[model samples]
Target: MAMAVGVVAAPLGLSVISLVNRLQDIFSRVGSHSSIDLPQVAVVGSQSNGKSSVLEALVGRDFLPRGNDICTRRSLVLQLVQIKPSQDEFGEFLHLPGRKFHDFS
Candidate 1:
């Protein structure tokens, strides 16, 4: 699956590496370099299929609904973020590919 996503993104001058978002988009010229926002990926599988285990391991959290016959009904956002310095404070930012930026510091 990882290889498949890499193949699909390669032809478009993109790579499948998990780079941290460094530059925040403000306003830019028409021909400026733009970022592409990858959609939030979710795991869709049957119950007891180890989906939760995978997610938990990735995020280092036990976010999977664990129980007998448990199934996830709603989508989950397992975002990776970075910390930043601010005036007399610190902040956090959501890591997206190249679209919208959200500040939940």
Candidate 2:
């Protein structure tokens, strides 16, 4: 259930938040921070079991594409990123380049 994931994710989330804070602190001291490549955590769960709904709620928008019931369509690598000038990306896949995926909701 979601509670299990929450229990496991809470610590990981805190650790990641602390790491980002430390990175920001370090960059601020450097006077000029060009950019940063942040790591991502994959949230794997049963298809259409409210996983997308949960993510959509967290993001406060419906950017992720939906798909048919019988097919996976696309494997999304969900990355929490800042939409700044330097960091301008929602997600990217390792196996594909310049290929953005979409699904039918």
Give TM per candidate: 0.37, 0.37
Give the best candidate by lDDT. Answer: 2
What is candidate 2's local distance difference test score?
0.59
For model 2, residues 6-95, the per-residue Cα lDDT tens digits are: 455546676786677567556656765556876544556776776766767877767665666734446554445444587434544545
Q: What RMSD, rounded to one decimal, does every model reach?
A: 13.0, 14.1
lDDT of each: 0.48, 0.59
Clashing pairs in 1: 35-98, 36-98, 37-98
Candidate 2's TM-score reads 0.37
lDDT string for model 1 (1-105, tens) is 457544444333222222422222231224445565644457778767887788778766454456687666555545444334553322232344444433322
